[model samples]
Target: MKRIGQAMKRMTVLLLAAALTLDPLAAASRQEKALAETKAQLLSHIAVLASDDFEGREPGTDGESKTLRYIGKQFFDLGLVSGTNDPGHPWFAPVTVLGREPATSRATFSRKGKRVFVLQQDVLVYTSGKRALVENAPLVFVGTGKTIPSRADLAGRVALLLEAGIDGSDRQTALIQAGAAGVLTVLDGDHTLENVAGHRQRLGYALGGEELGGDLDAFIAGKALDAALAGTKLSVKALQDRAAAPDFAPLAVDLAVSLEATTRETKIHTHNFIAKLPGKRPAQGAVLLMAHWDHFGTCAQPPAEHLICNGAIDNASGVAVMIEVARRLAKSPQLDRDVYFVATTAEELGLLGAKAFAENPPIPLSRFVAAFNIDSVAIGPAGQAFSIVGQGLTPLDADIAAVAKQQKKKLLMDNRAEAFVRRQDGWELLQHDVPAVMVTSSWGDVTRVEAFLENDYHRPSDVVSPRLELGAAAEDVDFLTALVRWFADPRRVPYRSAAKPG
Candidate 1:
């Protein structure tokens, strides 16, 4: 018996030594396993979401329904509670969207009561609302549409703007706010009149209750403007040249314009899928993680063999990364502040879903410690550098930089990615003064991104194939997981000084 007791003691000591020796290695193995599992999940999600079965995940369609169910199931399976704060429809926040397409448009211009023959094809007028009209409003050249005259000066006048790669919606909104009766953007950049007209001719979408545009928002061909300016002191070239001056201001043109447009509208009901991982101290504010679950449905018309725009890298990859990040965070220790996961709808339709969330948040907008948006994350290889889309626009840069350093990942500190800032869902949140950013490796290499944009972007060819590089995306998942944890620590990330309105 004494011999046996001594032997047992020796075995126990050996076991304790083994555990101590293997602890670090075991932890590393576990981390590697977790990362591998996340990569597998990321691939699986992209495949499923980008498949034809999803029908491109367009809002107000069966595709949307399937997407919502899939994302909701992921959240539920991850043990995330409803972030919507609604008891009935726990996972969704309803958003009403209006889709509009131009039906009929007409415009006429005159000078000194003499008729001006502006070709009908040269002017494209349309509205996202029911109808719009302008009756003999005087034309005021606003130059590049960067600066506008006062409400007093612009009231009851049609503003002629030079399109210079400016965001049309923002410019139109500014003109509208300045009391301009109408806006005519003259083609002044690389975009041809036909391309602009074709884009405007397609269906345009906006939030249901929101105003669409100025009374008569239209695009005018530069040649057409030149023709209208004939026999006058003002010329298209001269006006464009004058626009380059630093002191350029609104100049009145001796032209009277009348325009009318009617649009066909369709109302679509959609929902934003929101879920939450509750934290210990809810008052510390929450961290938001979001990705849009939408793409162009049936982008190709009949006679095309491939009709669906399988948005594998355009955004399915993004949503997959978001989900994998959520999964990793959920398994970690409880955070000091809650973390919310949002799968926004109708992002393809001018970020309508993101706008809806910002306008009517389940939680106060000010309560968000920080919001991180993932988008188009599957473009680069494993070692590619990452960039923040809204780098200098917010105060979260330092913390993000710290995380990147700790993870030993390459981070581009420039604001080059900001070129695409207005094109993503993050822009809507940023407009509402919420600190939102898209940290992605996809945009780090502009060459690759441009190639994807030129070839597969928005095309049926954007599918789950070998060409879709996801190694860097998997790394992004891990990095973003770290970011969520770091930000969710109330001790680490300070609360906002002044909270913005929801």
Candidate 2:
């Protein structure tokens, strides 16, 4: 009896050891080789959608209608639900934004203790957020501000931050977070004084500030002005020396923030085309995927040399990849939760599509498990597999990494850099507290952003190019498939407890 027991124990130990040892082959299978017919179906769809015949798929036009219907038909044919289905099915989300040209804004800031009026060159507009109005009133001087999630000092006043000082406060973020009347920031960020442009045009969109009025048409310029000093004192040189000091703190002034801005009255409608993949035991949560389908709408060129602004690669490729992923997933296997595939419109117009989608979605916003966005994967082989932007989100990275291993593709995150979490559509999701990630290769890279813009972006030549590579696209589709499968699986949910250091 003792000898028999000993033999069984040794056998059990041996089996466990072998199992651990056998775990090395990052298992990879060309499973698509089996789904060839499906691949053909998808490729044919992409070809037509990307061809010049589609006129670049711009929104609010005939081309947009044709493109939407075609992709919608593809979704229907694939058996996945439309994201707009009132219930757990197909759907369309209508989004809108205020589109208007800004009038020249002429305003003056009188620095406290200074008799000379400051240059308007110090301000810029931070126009990327919920649109609202800036009424005529005296802007209050709120010291270093406070925020919602974190308590910033700027509770209710317009932050009057000194040009180059770090007042132990993040002025811009704080003012916006605290909901100040409006932010009138100068070039106080960590920029070199020597590089400062002498002339400031209103507030450039790049800098984080806003025009006193939201979108009023007015004439303006930043001509030097004289101010009547009341309190202590300061001359232009003194003000310059103070504003230029890195630690300078903005002194409060009895300044009136009198500017006028009102809503456009008629709202601009943006859209988010949504699709769904129903899962088995869909845990109250869902797997979300977002892709922006809007590109620069039309080209402003002479008729003889003009053609539609074809956004074939800027977004047709992304839309194609997402559509294929939805199709492939519909047939392969089922998951525990629903999968939402969204193709947001007007992304080219300041991420209006993504912004609108996040504001109000068809599915219960809170039930979302995580978000995966496939932006631009024009090429790959950069690392082992393609590159993933915004892999910084803990839970998102874990799933992408695991799936990368399964596909025998490197879960390469360290080798690349993409402010992607904050750059494209992914950032919109991140703000809503959803764990989101964007998977892309070179096309997804930062250097590639301007590169694409320089060549095909918003240009007529953006149609499917002979030099374009579609093979890498297939790989992207495959990666997305694997990622969705990993997340939707009941027990294999994709949220990490901690973020791995790069």
Candidate 3:
């Protein structure tokens, strides 16, 4: 018995030695040092992007330009092709826009009716300011602001609109292209309504004048609108009649909005950085991994507008994840098809940058297989599994499930309910019929994510460290990295879901 006890002690000592020397299994294929690097990379990138210097990082601002340039420089150094740089440098894809520039002086904005009200309370216009008058500022009240050229007579009329479903469901772009003059827009309330195009993003005050520290036009929500119209002294119908024509003469029905502040009609140019890692097959399909780099640079107001919306968790974290994930793929073996890592801009302005990328894709849109989007890893505790907000609605669900298995995380599909899978750059891809999913957490429903976002989403409170849990984000990075590997190197592209579309 004493001999056996001595043998057991020796076994324990050997086990202790192994424990002291051998490394533990890591969630990621990358080692501790590499993981540390990734974590540090994420933290560092987020810290800078979410820093106060970038303000909210809105596009067209000095901060956004700086941010894009930084990302571009990093991509260039990472062995990626130069996508259109300043002059002669060739880019994989040049960032471009087809929009009017803002003006330096006040704009003359008015509609054809006294009672119709073309003023701020009833109208919202984003002008290039160089032009004093928006030709034919006629007010055609389309029911909800959805359908145009079919349900309503939209040719040669300025649209006075409410949210979708209020009049008819009309696409805003179609209305503008159909030769509608200055548009009059009404607030869509909040997310609770979910009315036609009732996106809460429209409520953001990060407009041109707002961010530039210039006075933005606003209506006092109550008597101000009434007082403006009381001065019109013209009938709504008579004003509408006067407004009808290719070029109608100006009448008393015209109302102009004047904000007492210096305006600049300067041209705004910004770009999104793209890095390509070619794959083996080169033709079957491609999976996109994306994140937005722009944030709320500056507010239309301070203290009240919360100044800078640093957007640490709002996006810098997501962009950092993209960089880390890209680095991993860069080091891995060839994939079946191409994988593109895109860091977008102007996402805060309605996913404009992403939309532009989609409309003019680097590859065939039909060949675009899937999109995996990361947006601010605000929750999702480590060792605790989570779900894709829009799981099972696409082919990616099975892949995510397989990932959950590899991660040992018990995944849930319908946990976030209404919020699941409806946001981030992935959702934009989903709209174009590409299979896509977004992973994020506004800290579950119980947490202060909503309030936090309300107060800090675009505010300086969005800074890194104090605003985020690096450990929690690390777990997400691991799970996501593994999933991306599986996605690009799958034996077969995952099958689409049998479920109906949302």
Candidate 4:
């Protein structure tokens, strides 16, 4: 009997050792398979979306139709619930886009009834709608124009402001609220008025009719500014230096500005693709994933090399990651809270889809745990750090750091946070008090983004090439998956707030 018991114990020990050795191997194999599958899907989706036939995947065009249908079908196939509130299993949220093209754009600035600025050279003007006209409005140099000064009242006056950091603050909103008639911002960066001339020609659109106010938002160069302040007590350079100081005063410059612009109006329709995976626990709140799928449409002026702006990196990469992540999560065990994936539209236009979604969400705003935006990603290799674009805007940095550590990668704040954080669709949700963050590879390695923008940011050359690698994008998918998993965990519900980092 003792010999029999010893033999059984030996057999049990051997079996336990075998299980331990094989379990890790099996897990490694499964992980590799999942990564391989996701990578393959990412490449395939980019190929299809970036094809020239899609006409650049522009909003409110044939490209939009094809793109939305493909995304909806993929989400449906992945078994995710429809993101819409409609009774049927519809995945689209129709958004109306009112596009206005500049017909006759003009901005003329004068000092004491003498013209000192040249249109498209010294100054450029843009309107919110079809036409904007402000004649002989007194221009008051309001420094940063961020807050209403105690002694200064800019009622019915044009506020001349030095360009401020783009930290998601709406300067125009503040200026308008301060009773300013219009705003004329001086170009402060390395860019000149000529550099921004091309932007005034792009199609401008708004989400709702009321959102497009009849305000003049114009850009002026240093040359015109110098001419305006030529004989004034405060020189342009001196005033700019003083404005940078902490104790700055609002100055009323000795100049008045005039603007007249007209745009041809066009009405179009766009769609936001949404899919949700309901969780077991409802109180944990839902996790939102966002990626803009729209790009520059069929170029009115097609380039010679490639007629279409195949935005392989601008967003096809992001949508592919979102789809792959959704597929994997759909098959995984039930999460503690719901996960929502939104493929926003008109992001190229002006974050119209995101604005619409924020304005009318499928669920209550308070139920959203956190919002994550994935834009133009992976232009580099894996193992590199990931940047949180709106790092200080929310407390999600802790969550991002934790995920990065688990992936054996690094976490850093976006170096150009002020410039990019509010530029993406995430900004719309952030404005509505949703804790949103944009994760990208461009945060730390500014060169990667600069290279992309210089070569193919919004041009026809943006087509997928050997230079555009997917290693970093693949890693980001894993990082985002981990974040969602954490957010969905009932025991790990995140604290939602809009506290800026000190």
Can you write out model 3's per-residue Cα lDDT over 1-502, one digit (the tens) per residue? 9999999999999998776566455324335566466667778888787777776677777887667766766666666554322234244344443333333322234444223333332322333232334443444555344345433354445555443332222455455566554344443333122232243213322223222322122112223334445645644343344445444432323454433222333333666676776778655566778888887666646446456777888888787777777666667776776777788876776676777677666665666667877777754344444657666667777767777777676676665534635556777787888777764433333254455556666656676665476555666677666776676664656323213222
User: Candidate 1 has what TM-score?
Assistant: 0.83
Cα deviation at 308, candidate 1, in Å, is 1.1
| Model 1 / residue 405 / CA error / Å | 3.9
What are the lDDT figures for the candidates, one per model? 0.87, 0.58, 0.57, 0.77
Tens digits of per-residue lDDT, candidate 1, 215-305, equal 6778888888999999889888999888899999889999999988999889999999999999998888899999999998899988998
TM-scores for candidates 1 onward, in order? 0.83, 0.68, 0.63, 0.74
By lDDT, the better pick of 2 and 4 is 4
Measure candidate 3: CA RMSD: 9.7
Model 2 per-residue lDDT tens digits across residues 302-327: 65374666666667777888888887
Query: Who is ahead in TM-score, 1 or 3?
Result: 1
Runs with alpha carbons beyond 4 Å of true place in candidate 3: 1-38, 53-56, 76-92, 96-266, 300-307, 378-380, 415-417, 420-423, 440-448, 494-502
Q: State the displacement of the C-alpha of residue 348, model 4, in Å, after optimal TM-score superposition.
A: 1.2
lDDT of 4 by residue, 418-455 (tens): 57777888899999878899775534576787788798
All predictions: root-mean-square deviation over Cα?
4.1, 10.3, 9.7, 6.5
Worst 10 residues of 3 by lDDT: 213-222
- Candidate 1 minimal-lDDT segment of 10 residues: 493-502
